[model samples]
Target: MSDSTDNTTFDSEDLNFDDFQLEDFKYEAPFQPAPEVQRDLSFFKSIPVTVTLEVASKEIALGDLMKAGEGTVIELDKLNGEPLDVKVNGSLMGHAEVVVVNEKYGLRLVDVLDSALTGVGH
Candidate 1:
């Protein structure tokens, strides 16, 4: 029909090549610094410290371990009345002993060992 032909022509005209143009394209970008802002290095130097309590031990055979059970008490080198090793960041710093302060258990520094072993304080 002429009406159907007119409808088809109208639809084709909607998608015609004259209706499209590439001049409408756009490019946008804000100016930014090439190098990012640097943080203060001094903040890294003031890291929180922790004192490590280490019970020095030695490895034994599995057969010996099988012989150890409930009543068996594994002994250590620093026994009662001996000063225990006090470490800082996995390094042997000094020695300490168990003490009670205000009804709470704490470590009392007994001696400051020579730093030659640690290669520090020299």
Candidate 2:
């Protein structure tokens, strides 16, 4: 058997954290501006994108389509001078007007559809 006595000593006043100072260790951060990061957008630009210019569409029956041949005139639903729908990878990206450049058909962008708000490009 041993003597059951509380002989541990502890003084709250002896423990002082106010005498600590960080000046004992010399530390100086080098005067260096952040490195300029050049973003390379060539990868995104190199990606193949399909741009479609929607002119018009017409729903015709299978029997009527078979009956039509060369010299047959089919009418579309879109009116003349109407803005054409521009689609990118099957997504509606914007609207454009048809133009002729160097005897080639070209499209002039008129309105750009917001992909973030409209969730167009997915």
Q: Residues 31-113, candidate 1: write the lDDT tens digits.
A: 87688755555554466667876656657889988999899977766666777889877778898888899998788888877
Which model scores highest in lDDT? 2
lDDT at position 86, candidate 1: 91
In terms of lDDT, model 2 sits at: 0.85
Candidate 1 to truth, TM: 0.48
Q: How many residue pairs clash in all the candidates, one count each?
A: 0, 0
Residue pairs in steric clash, candidate 2?
none
lDDT of 1: 0.72
List ranges where model 1 is wrong by over 4 Å.
1-45, 116-122
Which candidate should be chosen as best, given TM-score against the real structure?
2
lDDT of each: 0.72, 0.85
Local error of candidate 2 at residue 50 (angstroms): 1.1
